[model samples]
Target: MDHQEMADVESQNLETPPDVFLKGKHQVTLKFDDVVYKIKTKKGGLLAKKRETVVKEILKGVTGVVEPGEMLAMLGPSGSGKTTLLTALGGRLGGKLHGSITYNGEAFSNDMKRNTGFVTQDDVLYPHLTVLETLVFTALLRLPKSVTKEKKVEHAKGVIDQLGLTMCKDSIVGSPYLRGVSGGERKRVSIAQELLINPSLLFLDEPTSGLDSTTAQRIVSTLWELACGGRTVVMTIHQPSSRLYYMFHKVLLLSEGNTLYFGKGSEAIEYFSNFGYAPSLAMNPSDFLLDLANGIYTDEFNADHTIDKQKLISVCKVNCVAQSKPALKGIYDSGKDQNRLQEKDSEKWPTNWGQQFLVLLRRDVKERRHESFSVLRVCQVLVVALISGLLWYKSDISHLQDQIGLLFFISGFWGFFPLFQAIFTFPQELTMLQKERSSGMYRLSSYFMSRVVADLPMELVLPTIFLFITYWMAGLKANVVNFMYTLLSLLLNVLTAQGLGLALGACVMDQKAATTLASVIMLCFLLAGGFYVQHVPNFIAWIKYISISYYTYQLFIGSQYSYGETYPCLTGQCSIVEFPSIKQIGVHFGLHDQLMAALGLLIMLIVYRLIAYIALMRIGVTKN
Candidate 1:
């Protein structure tokens, strides 16, 4: 059968009740008029002596509408403002936007946000997570607290079934390097995540860009069914096959930031034909439309017939002005209804603080479990621990220098390892975080706290294991109290270093730059850690005070030996308090005060994390 007939048969088989998911929810009617978006960009090369700021318009006076139970497909070539206009309609665009975009004759509000779903082209998913787990976590975080946990899971399963993902429900989402779900399945999973919220309006960016033709048809058909269920679905697409073209209820063609055509998909050919832009032979409607928008003429077109881009834009502008007047008037006439909407939209988050924290913490733990406990990471820690243990195996008291060096190595190893590992946490997850936060899944504070809390145990486990293996082999101390003190100090040091890494990652938001800065900072800490240079220059002496390694080394030394402990002197004579190792560690300068060293580390633990939290708050949720 042909595509249209195939689509007709499939639609008949796939039809369901309109209110299956959106029952009792508001049905949104999206309308935009005179929408224009511009950005300020610099116009000069890096080596140029001078640079100039220029305002570039991305969308120019574009207008259209998609009411309940209809789907609008935005079509254009690259740089035609298709994505920009879609973002504006979705209320996610920022920077010099001049337009009137309304939902159900009301301005965009928190309520509208709560009821809208935006699926980005890139599927921001945890590759290790099963499709079921992914959707369940989304439902738990985004659904209102009124729904019980069991009911939320049920809803997620329902969405999975609705989108034909039941077969892959237990499968991992996967990534480029890892084998998992197929590309089409991944796209549906993205759509399923948004559908968990039962949004009244859905916006997607090129939902079928990289898929095969059959998969693309299936995705578009699924969207058609969603629009059939009373949701306003709008998406940007490149050239689509004629079958998929006919699936959309409305088609909006854009060219160079201007609207080329808007109205019913079935009538688009007739509308364009009226302008004498019809193809002489059979052609995919989308192909023909794109050629006109891109100013490309096929062999089928008459050699003598020429089309002017500006003239087409002018005609579309006049047509848009005439078509948008009535819808714009209706929007202006609903001031009272808009006020009611504003009041109804007061709830900023669907779940309270505590609930958001618990749900997010659980999800974070599940998603990161493999990374934190992978065989490779565990083996790395074990190898390092074994090497350190064998190198420092049970030395005599006369070898005080070697023992102290081992302690310093312990401090330096942990201080470096955890910080480097933690630097990738924020930069890698920034995109996913922005997507979830923009959809109002939870508060940034809640997400931040849950993330830190979830990582605490995982971050500490390896270090604890390493220390247990290395401490006994090196015979540092046998007393339980002393061992506890050393372990506590090591854990605190790990946390402090990790906190610094988090701060750096959140501040820079770039993995390479953050790692580079972290390397420089860690090296400075190590050089001034009091083990390498006994007396740093007085001008820069304060560096040791803030160094996590400095405090940790002091704590390790104080825990391993007593203030008046004696060691066999190299010269066969020495005072108990004047031993070379004791003098080298500056025990006389209060370096043996374990309490003070621990307190310093404790302060850094709080301070660095506070800085990280502040940086995250500044990063905030991306609205543009």
Candidate 2:
């Protein structure tokens, strides 16, 4: 074929959509039997001689089945284990979970998790991304590769339409500090993200928790539509409106971690009525059910003669057997159907490592650009650099005191600034990262590695500019090689500082706590920094080894004074040497060579990053 003909063939191939093997509808029936979850808690003061550990059961023998084409809304007051039950069925619970959970008669595994999606109560989303960008990114990372690029884009658009987000497609999903989409729209965007993969089963925890009545109705209505299309949906809701209550096909009522009632939503009112807890014409059915569950009764109902809790449990247990017949029959039918069908391979992550990194890099870049603090950050750097240059204008080695002073200032400036900037990096994105991590969007390594790589350009840019303006203006080192080494040392110092910051952020999840701890630690390191105390006591002298500022000061001074600057003696005569050479000074502190110091900085960078990675892995994603 000619060159033009080959090009045309490639173009056609790029545009052609890959064949989509629709394996019928993804109708799933999730069944859980006697699932019990518990956690151990410590009860004691910090100074107590002995601490007691107590085991608390968060979920108690929860057994139920949610069939496709049905919506199960878990209703209960606060602290009633509603969200816990939903999470258990969603396969998100960790630790030793008692009992069995099966999908379509098969036991639950990672495959079941891959085919399911969960939407938490909080809307975890990229605040700086537009609705379209957010959904497209999710689609790229989620949808199978067999789906063409065009098809994925079309799919994202379709989800936006389905979620009633077309009006805000171009609007940015903003946070508390940034103004963009409304709360309702942001919630829809969160739902749209999970909808990209067309999950067979969807679990939502309070989908309408913070939304207004109308918006909540719309969200629940959307779930109803999804159920009608053969997707099993289980959600936890508290005090839903009457209209919203009827939208759910089934309702699972709970109180104090025990099932009070489980049956069709329509039958719940009648079921409660049979027990003498029926609602008046003016009262909402949902309100009456909640009242009954919480042991609250209005004047219309005799509070003195309230229905006994044990009696109600006995009635619900008897009804559960009758109510489960349809679900058991459905499971049996599904088993027979499965024998005649070809078992399709479970879905895997669509993107490769390189692709994930690239896409994440692009998204991070876009987010950083839109962040209001980003512009402020650049301005802050420039202003600080300019001020430092002005403060130490045309500094010379004629006075060794001034030279030492400049070195200490340079050390402190780079140490403090970059450390705080890096400190907030992990904590700021902790929620979003944890949410995406739970969804299997990308590996922690991919995210951490890509983030480090993505930060390279910006992380270096400001330091380079600061070095250029300050080094020449301060008249530190005039030679090109000396200037380059000085610049490289400062850059490495910044990287090391940032690494420490990231480690602190990951080790401590709370921002205020991490910030406070980082400040204290940085201050301690600063005091141990060489210039602050020329002669350190032997007792605390080992601290110098871990202080980046100490090494930076050594390299900064060594790189400059190694050029043999003449110092004025007491008698106004030039002294050949009063202090040791920069290399010799570093040797006294165990930084034997400039190469060794640079290598030490690099080592610190690697060590801290490893620490952060391990901390993140250990403290996995938190559900609460």
Candidate 3:
């Protein structure tokens, strides 16, 4: 295309029908000049006396322009700064960057972020959620509130069809351990997620890394169509087949952080041939370019050893200046139209607080329902309840010690079960959380609150079932009031233990470490539960005060004997309150002590979860 035609194309607005996905969206032209990025690394071995900080250049003097309705493919070998340069242009890179990157002649701003969509190389998606479900939730959280719920659902469906995901829309976006959609379909689903916002500028990192050649071609074709529909698409690709290479409108070739070629994909072979670096055999253009970038030369082209990779880099540097100057001029001339496309980004989130909470709660429920209600967990609760009930069946006043033992068992069992289960929650989902938060999807408060709220039903059900079975079978207390109090104590203990788990998970963010730490902490709490060791030393006596198991055990003992009941003595008359088990459990303190134990549990419920929320906030949303 000529310069004037290019200018006209960049200036005019491409209109689409109201029902179309890309309708009424602003088009962005991305321009970067002499981009350079560097990072500091420690340059000493482990045994070295001192480690020196060394500055390493990742991207050196890279420049390019991707006009609206054009697809720019950054091609290079591994570790060639392809991902770094792409990240820098996307405005998501951190560290020391030296360059000027702008969208439509304007600097990067919140509005640009709103209009930009970035798809990472690894697809960050929930393994349990179906494709359609995933897209629907994303739309609900991302689409403007002005749009109706029905409209968002319809839009998600349209995007699914647009990306040819109709066949697998109902399938789960599975992980390595689970079977779901194919790699190609998963990649397309990832693309469809970003397309829901109708972004004007799309950045993808290796959209076809593990796919076959045919699948890679299809992905590129979709991107090509997206670019043709007035969105500027930029992606980093390792190598592409000949057919795939022809799909990109522009290709930026880099080697060792230096640009080797930056021009039309169709003219790359001829451009490199002029430097006496042409391939003799008929091979894929991408393969030839990679070979040249990696300093690999054929025997036919090695006759002149002096003509090396440096000469090719020097030649391309001079040619790019002359070629890019004219294109850059055409882009700048249309700055007036580009300036008019700036969107109003006053609203930080597309959805309100209540909406974010409800949507996230719904998503969390769906994603966790399987694991929570799985057969293994159900069987575990049922087996333990049956075993405990059989072990302490029909214990009356004569078997008061047996009943106390069962109560202690309940405390220790729940204290450990929920604590270990809850520790894995945050660490497992940290990646997805980071990805969504980085995109400004919702508030961290909403996510954390929804997570806690979602676990309420799932976390409480099994414990209630266990208590109901064991309470009636063991015959602890025939009265309804006593049973209700005991049930309440157990349920509260479960939540408090789960809260401790969440705090540890969020604080450590590593599954193995969190689990190990939780085990050690729960063991200490169990040991100090006032049942195992009644008289702890003064230095360690405070452990029982902080132990969830101790409070729960105290509540159980207090609830049953607080009514001043008496037990049958073997030799003479003796009150149940005078027994060592009952006395040590603090039954003499009566209702006041029972209330204190309940209050202690309530305080732990709030405090541990509050700690979890603060830790999550400290994690922050920025990815770098």
lDDT of 2 by residue, 1-624 (tens): 432233345334433232232355456777776678898989899899999998888876666788777789999889889988887787777876897787887765555655678999998888888999999988877776677878989999999998989999999888888898998888888888887877779999999988899999888878877777767889999999867877777788887777788877767766776667665445555787777777765545444345566677667767774577567667756765742222464544556777778778888877775442478887887888788888888877665667677777877888888788777888888878878877777767778887877777777888888888877887776899888878888888989998998899899978899889988888878787766666778899888788897778777766765434457766674533345433323433233666776777889999999999888888876421
* Model 2 quality (TM-score): 0.90
Clashes of each: 0, 0, 0
Q: What lDDT is reached at residue 336 by model 1?
A: 48
Each prediction's TM-score versus the true structure: 0.94, 0.90, 0.91
Cα lDDT of model 1 overall?
Answer: 0.84
Q: Give candidate 1 misplaced runs (Cα > 4 Å).
A: 1-21, 299-306, 334-342, 573-585, 588-592
Please give, for residues 483-558, the per-residue lDDT of candidate 1 as tens digits.
Answer: 8888988999999999999999999998999999999999999988877887567899888888888888878877
Better of 2 and 3 by lDDT: 3
Which residue runs does candidate 3 get wrong by more than 4 Å? 1-21, 45-47, 301-311, 314-318, 321-334, 339-345, 568-578, 581-588
Ranking by lDDT: 3, 1, 2
Cα deviation at 369, candidate 3, in Å, is 1.2
Query: What's the lDDT for all of these models?
Result: 0.84, 0.76, 0.85
lDDT of 3: 0.85
